[model samples]
Target: MRRQAVSPSCQQLGRPRSGAASRRGVLSSAAAVLLLAAGQRPSFATLIPDAPVVGDCPECIGEVNETLNACPLDAPSCISTLSDDEEHFAAPWQFDGTREEAIEQLISIATGARFDMGLIDSFGGVRQTDAAAYIAKGVLAVVSGGDMPEQPKRQRKSSTEFVPFDGDVTERRTTPGGAEYVRIVLGTGGGGATQASNLSEVIDCEFLFLPDDNIVDVRASSRVQPEGKLGSGGQLALSITEGLVLDKNVAGRQVERLRKALRWDVAPVLTDFNPAFNAEAPVWFERLFDPFNRRNKFQPSGLAYPAEGEGEERPLRLPARE
Candidate 1:
């Protein structure tokens, strides 16, 4: 005789109340699963399209795998061979210009010369400091009378003056490979100027160029003292380390990162080594060079009159103010 088959729920009827509840729970779970299968897809898969794979380029995958297998030991060799070359001061220039052009440009920077603004526009509205240097050199050539002018001097008070201490071409040489390098040290310090002066400024700077390496390094230090009326009466010091080079790809990446962090697309990075300032300028002080309000003043006696004149005009007094 065949025994009648009993439902699982029917078998649980003889168990405790929890057994009946457990049977209902199982039935509820099965129903829920069926409902889920019938409805829309889960949230994770919704955003991603129904592609077979994400970014599934075989070549890229192979490259990633190869890089990973190299481990930390061989990592240094993985970088491109032509990457940035940091060498001693005697290293040859790595730039893409002729030796004569490089020398002219280096000399221009040693003197306080300004370049054409068009050079900045060439690099897509960015601060191409390297290009600016070359352009400045060209301007210096045009303005110069075949020789650099005398270093500037400023009078601190009666019988006292501050002149550039080491205003000379420190290094001018050609490498064994025929590449030219120029370095100029321009600075003023150790002043015996008058102690009664209200304000005095001292500046020391160095400029170096490696044409073959396409690198420029600038090191500068400046100090401004205000004894009275200039401000609350303190010393304002500034130091800068600026190294620039011609680089587009890495510069573009730098610009992109800056754009994201700043939430605005600013100027492109035209030079690799950006200028660095150790301390921010106080808000009260204006920029050292104001392009808009540049003034040129000179004594007219040197322009026209003789070196010596009559007793009344000896001092060469200009017309009285209106």
Candidate 2:
């Protein structure tokens, strides 16, 4: 029989589904993380700690030196990627409070939404076609990766992903990191993409993740060498982009009331993760993220349950994770 390498048991990980899993006190400080390996997990945002590991490249450095990190800042919401379904919601949960309350609220409410990774690029098509097919069928993925942004014509932008919509979206915003822009990706057509290098050179970015937290943060910082020939294919450009772009949907019953009262029509999706991903680390990893979006691609069964009574107002329940 083959012998297995002796290693740290799951119990010795020192992080067995912390706070929210237990549904109790606020989760461990954002600085704390689930230890899968002994050290050096690259942070895609908040999924993995910003701690350094051995043989690491010098380009990607975390926001802070891992000190002076505090609450609210430490709040999980700050770290998570907000979901599109939480438009206009009165956030009943906070990152610093009881984890149970946050979990309870999430479980009680139906988070109506779907997470999908689409394919519209040939360069990455061969690699991601399988994953794309899965999402098309409404299957869920915990984490996904495939292809480079070869589809959607290249404008001037940096990217870690492509959007689901292939055409014009009524509303679009510049992705955080001061790099990504909003543009229509027409299915297989190359629409909006960043500058390119040799078609053969595909940079592979493996992101570390923080599960259970609605707000999973992943990001990277880069620095080009001081000297490299431009025409010779040598350029040192440093760019750090937080992974995951959150697009929200319209929700809530305050359309006319709020429009007239506030003199502004606020779409419900405004309640999602910040339009711009902060370069800083989050304090609470799970509180701000949608439970379903945390570890898998979940489609809520009922985005919004139809009204139960003829003339009664109650919380509009949405979908559940698939």
Candidate 3:
């Protein structure tokens, strides 16, 4: 007698599910098996067109893999190296006043010099303890500056404006030797999205005030940007230090005493070092792909200073210099 072949759905029906559901599941499984046999697979590149593929640059992939294997699991968080745009100044800048008075004096002198140099548009002391509050205030200041109307030709110095002390402005600490240390962080950056001419920059300044020794030590450093050739971090640091020491009129008796006591020239010494030299890619990866992607570059959606006859309102033109 000839025996009838058992269908997959018929076999599954006796094992578990209802006849209709089992038939559907069996059909789906068969379709998947046929697809696999035909060498058809899902393409991730189709789903994410912009995603980088390792196979695209086999050499880079190999190098990356080698680097990963070479990097130790227990490596130091930060590797210390010399800075290229760091300036250090130490002198007998004795202050015959309390710590609070010294801090106030420093702030006043710094703020005045920055304003005179047109480095900052607006600045204030950081009172709130949290990092969030400090960052929020800085962000708000940038937003406000962006909304501000263009100043008169004579009043406006440069196109760029900065808001400083975007992080912890002042921090006080005591050493095991009972010596007091005060770290004053002075960060300055561009006026945000509105200011197209301005580029973001960060200046990390730490001031160590030692009352017993009657000397104040200062270290100012900034990252050297490839695009920012005109603004030297060394020059910026020197400018501020010079203003503090040489501004006899504003600094009053404290600076006067310090100057008189100092036998040698009080100048900041510049040191150059780059810790990220080998850690990062040789060239910025963004710039490599920038030609293919216009979005990588900044495009002003709205103009802070629109051109004359281009908008509904007449643009304010700067008067020609005599």
Candidate 4:
């Protein structure tokens, strides 16, 4: 769950900050104030020198200090005063495979049957596969959750529905830095007439294949404003990273399905947890104040496949392979 910060000037260019971003800004100021009152050195103050300080603040500074010191810096929304770039989330990985193997892995995860089955039990199941068909044509459309009218009434719903969107995928090319990469431009709509006009949700995903480094950098950025929590784009990037290089001892039905799909000789090791996927507070905070840390956490909105005994499995309509 690594984030890239942009300059304040860049953040202010035409795009108004979201309420969540504003709230985070206020909380950052409060944290800075607590740091000043406690006579403790602020680590991130240099990044945000303009943060406000309160005069003669409460004695709760000690409590705040204790919590801040105990928590990990990368915890979701944990001490992140820096404004994230429109490219909200990055999930880079080093794997024991060749560039060709890495490309195959990406394709398998995006279009394979086993991977599709794995997603059925998970949150936000695939409602359609036409968008995925583009991957074979050198374009990948990473579908995220978006709202759509639930038919008959033609009223908009919340951002919890799985609506398919299509985006153009650029051909593989070499970067100026000598790294090979593919750029995927994704957005809601462009798939069908019924798809809502969610141009604001457009995002670009870049898959950078570093030369001789065995590293694949998966970066997702929104074209509109920077993302606060784990949106659909962030989740898709994280899921792709997990599929390619899962760490050892990370147990989940998804992981099991991935193993069966790829049929790797050795299971990949789990090195670090993606903050957007699984954020944890200190043990004390979890035991005493769990709900506070759980705020803004990412939860899967819908399932990928229908449940058992519901009905016969319906075939997904995908573009025929040439």
Put down candidate 4 lDDT per residue, 1-322, tens digits, no spaces. 2223355685576687799998998898899899889975455311111111212221101112111011122222111101121112222455566878866675445332233222432224433343344233332222333343222222232335433224445346665566776644444333322222232234334456667777664443333332333331123222321232222111112222333444333323322223333232122234344544432232221112222354333332332212
lDDT (C-alpha, whole model) for all candidates: 0.29, 0.25, 0.31, 0.35
List clashing residue pairs in candidate 1.
Answer: 93-212, 93-213, 94-212, 94-213, 94-214, 95-212, 95-213, 95-214
> C-alpha displacement of 118 in model 1, angstroms?
6.5
Error of 1 at 133 (Å): 35
Name the candidate, 1 or 3, with the larger TM-score value. Answer: 3
Candidate number achieving the greatest TM-score relative to the actual structure: 4
lDDT of 1 by residue, 1-322 (tens): 2123345786666676677888997897787788679873222111111111112231111112111111111111111111121110111123346546655654553343333222122354334564566567766976874554343232122223212122335445554544443433233212222221211222222223433445433222122212322232322333222123222122122212222322222222221111221121111122334323211111221122223234122233433212
Sort all candidates by TM-score, best to worst. Answer: 4, 3, 1, 2
Name model 2 segments beyond 4 Å from true: 1-206, 221-322
- TM-score for candidate 2, residues paired by index: 0.15
**Rank list by lDDT:** 4, 3, 1, 2
Reference-based TM-score of each model: 0.21, 0.15, 0.26, 0.31
Q: How many clashes show up per model? A: 8, 37, 5, 8
Assess candidate 4 and give its TM-score to the true structure: 0.31
